[model samples]
Target: MGTSGDLPDGFGPTIGTLGEDPLVAGVIERYPSAPWLTVGPGDDAAVLDLSGSRAGALIACTDTIVEGQDFRRDWSTARDIGIKVAAQNFADVAAMGGRPHTLLVSLTTPADVPASWAHELADGLAAECSRAGAVVAGGDVSAGTEIVIVGTALGSLATPSAVLRSGARPGDVVAVTPGSGRSAAGWALLRAGLVSSAFEGLLSEHRAPVPPYPAGVEAALAGATAMIDTSDGLVRDALRIATASSAVLGSSVVLDLDPGALAASDDLLRAASALGVDAAAAAEWVLTGGEDHCLLACFPSPAVVPAAFRVIGSVLAGDSGVGVRLGGKPFDGEGGFRHWS
Candidate 1:
């Protein structure tokens, strides 16, 4: 059976890897825009220019993180959670081939939680925003039983182009920049009581998913027609892009992965195995699990596949509906994390 791939390090976020998280494809489809708008939610952020020219126009996006649902106070620290909240949102901005410019954060927390958490959160936001070449423009605070973080990002394409998910076509080689699965492994460790520094290092990844923004921009420049992040399992996520772009994606093909990532993954799996958890099954946590915030993308030509990426599959024309195909047939295993099931 065809197995979903671990996203490589460089390509931008894509539905091919992440499946559907935050907002599904239908949501973006609902909000079509005019030319003057420039970019829309379907890409990274929304761009609008009072000026007719697309050059030097402004682009922006808004994303949120909720407690109990998006994150757990027990698992993540105030600072890490804060940074993670901002980092992933900002990654979305980069995914659209937009440069991150500014961020606005809104926080909610229980009365008993430490107030220092907010400051720590701000620090993390500042660090990540600065790293992304963006600034913390503004923010707000409120109260609630669980923690919630809302971030808004502002950016610029400098020229006015939004990298979309439905651009993949037949003959296009599918490749990913980097691999994503560490977070799922780390999360599995935490769930398995292996919360030691030796094992839970992936917790850092889970808290703050490092999406290769530059890689995404590079992909766009390198004829990456379609892009997405691995927020869901590979099969499920790639299918979304295939269905949208009318192409087929397979994970059984040769795909490159970071040695460090592979090593880290092996360790996590070993620990999970000792805990009676399926390390291979745990691999699917990120493969199929949502919230890793990794990027997945499609390249128009094999030349566009960078050294960091591997040719995981190809976009085929014929019928719509993406799936895990191995040996020219549908490969099914772990479906994906279902909501409310």
Candidate 2:
């Protein structure tokens, strides 16, 4: 699409006129140097010197979010989009019990789009990177039909090594960080057109997730057996750990939840009630809702979990499968966001 037939269709300004360096420069201006980075964003390549950092190994992961697929431009601002991509990327590094130090952002957008969108997006990415104690290293920008944001995070693991999902044992306790379902609840409200002052937090959560970055390292130090980011949903990711740990398919792990805990989120419950969604269905957001990016780890029985981690359930010695149970009964409803129904 375009302003006219001859002109390229874009958001704010055309990419052809400004070219790549200026846009790259805009990004470079926003991100400062981190201690671990030898060379920052402006160079031909970003170099990281972790020799003094004392990391045993390097951890890296890449993730992408596309327009219409992962998010709606109308619903999310450039800053929100930036925070989301950065936070989720950090979540993956954290899942491995590593501390993120740098990020490489790859962006694709239509030529006709405004340059400000790109700048704002960079600002958003930089902001989140700083929050995680990381910096934007370098990345690629290209023209595409839709807005696409991809972020790759680099981190280091200390003495115990990267925590794998397969480490969970049958007797381990399942634990998770705080704040679970606000994003799902917010999504429900957005879909239902129920936006209001009452739903601000939920709505914000959906736009930009805040994962517990330090908890990953904390969990590892505290002896977490297995770890994963519940970006996919609790049941699904739990199943990943269960299968990786070689638990039987029918009854390997049970993600037990407390009734009091479920009821504790007054705003989420209230949002559900306002939308006429029952308690069970609302609770489904907590169990199956994806994108909150919270850490779920398994610790040994009598696990001395870190201060931020809360024990929710336990791995069971039984058949194969992951179960989400509340009050000891199997939870009924859908779990998490799936790309395809």
Candidate 3:
């Protein structure tokens, strides 16, 4: 029943009553009113003003992370979890060619979870929102058996129409932001118990990925034909755009990727060697890794591709259903993470 100011530094015996808990109060206190948020936390529902945008359309996306399924407390801190969830949601809005505007967060945790942990999680979420040019309007917290965090991001389009997965064309060029395979390599290192400082950067990325928040808007402005967030692996997500575009365009689409364009970086190669794996394994991580949250987009031509994006492949007419090919051969390697598999 103590105020947020009176909360102790370490984990308490259990979370207190919801009505008088410091965790909720602390989280509410952390967010202030913004120009876009007419009503913030401490209210039943947040009121956002979108009239300022030239394009009145709204973009919304939601993503969830569970305790054991999406993350582990031993490997990632509350702040890390917050950053990861926020980044993923923001990336979704960006992929749609929108500017991230506000976020609604919902958190459920076991009674054993400390108030400090919850507060830290709020800080992490707020920090990421600031980085993405957005705000945390409001959210809910409840008691549960395990930690569950969900983020619903609402954004405003910068262009007349939001870019979609079905907008790709046969002659479009495929491109991606700078990061790929870093998160997967980080996961590999963590799973193998290879916590050496040499792999700290990779481990950090796995814990909390830093997505290219601005590149989405940039691509849209530069006339990107289609775009997607690389939450799944490169090939899997690229295939998503191909499939969607194919259905709309009435022709099978194939994304022909150049292997040299996606070669493993030096850091990835080092991690591969340390794990007793070869460069091929490292390359697989880039191809099949997920959670990096980078932007994958198709432009009308290589000349129109934004500088922030690197040309990696091209769209082509396919003889069969939509698929991805590497070096002109159909890729058969495993896809990214999937539930119930």
Candidate 4:
């Protein structure tokens, strides 16, 4: 196995016993304390000061990314993986109209993996947390066959109550943050091995997606009826809101997306052409591409929608089951990425 010296700068020396490992020590040093943390890393557990929360409510969500499943080492660096994991976890809190506060990460890696990889991973996690105004309070490490990262995010509701997916009404207007399909388009370009500089923007998005973290709280403050993080895909996450709202409202709700409003961007079209596919294929990426981690929200009216979000669809009363329609027509194509096909 390679030592930390074999890795990049700031990676420090090779790994030793867990208690004496420089990598673990480096991570602890990077994330010492935060305003909300009463007790930071180094102890058996961390303590938080939630008494100052106006709502006295804490929002929590956890997500895991596996080596072969969620990402590929050849496709992304350890730092990129860390940023992605932290982004997705924090996005969940933002989706619920909360302010992200702290994160707990559990990392499992093979013994042969370089200690610097772990150090870079911690740096990445801390970077993303800093972007979200949060900190890595504590976590655990274990040996495994492949790298796996499990992140749990803690947040406080900005509003009196957390916004939920089940709050959308028939008259609600659906909106989303900008740059929805760039990550998916980037993935397509990567899968095709098209490393042209023209698509570098898209490729970067895939490696380290910059989710609109503030939009969630803005939507909540602007009177959003319901919300979700677009980690899965646009249409699929939209359907999630529709279905959840349907059950609560005792009626089938449909999200009628405006095709013109959700049209593919020039970059996606270019990617599609490079891949020798039709424009529809590019449009599909916009519709079904996941990992953008943008927010999809429903507001009571278009006028109430926040400036950060653009109106893309509207909620309608459905006849039988909850569903989605593009331009008032049934979408027959497959939805976004699924765990098990």
The lDDT of each candidate is 0.61, 0.81, 0.88, 0.86
lDDT of 4 by residue, 161-278 (tens): 8899999998899999988888888888888999789899998889888888899999999989999998888989998898899999998988889999999999889999998999
What lDDT does candidate 4 reach at residue 236?
90
- TM-score of predicted structure 4: 0.93
Q: Estimate the overall C-alpha local distance difference test score of candidate 3.
A: 0.88
Task: Name the 10 consecutive residues with the lowest summed lDDT in model 1.
Answer: 251-260
Q: What range of 10 consecutive residues in model 4 has the weakest lDDT sum?
A: 10-19
Off by over 4 Å in 1: 1-57, 158-160, 247-265, 320-327, 331-341
Please give the lDDT score at residue 14 for candidate 4: 42
Q: Which pairs of residues clash in candidate 3, taking residues 3 or more apart in a chain or in different chains?
A: none
Worst 10 residues of 2 by lDDT: 247-256
lDDT of 2 at 97: 94
- Any idea how many clashes model 2 has? 20
Ranking by TM-score: 3, 4, 2, 1
Q: Which ranges of candidate 2 are over 4 A from the true structure? A: 1-12, 247-264, 321-333
The TM-scores of all predictions, comma-separated, are 0.73, 0.89, 0.94, 0.93
Q: What TM-score should be assigned to candidate 2?
A: 0.89
lDDT of 1 by residue, 160-259 (tens): 4677777776667776655456667666666666677776557777777776767666766676777776666555666666666642333212222222
Runs in model 4 lying further than 4 Å from the true structure: 1-20, 53-55
Q: Pick the winner on lDDT between candidates 3 and 4.
A: 3
- Sort the candidates on lDDT, descending order: 3, 4, 2, 1
Per-residue lDDT of candidate 3, residues 1-341 (tens digit): 37776665663444654333567788878765587687788878998877764346888999999999889998988899899989999999999989887888999988777777787788889889989888999898887898899999999888899999988888999999987999999999999999989999999999988989889999999999999998888888998998898899998888899999999999999999999999999999999999888899999989989889999999999999437899999884476878667
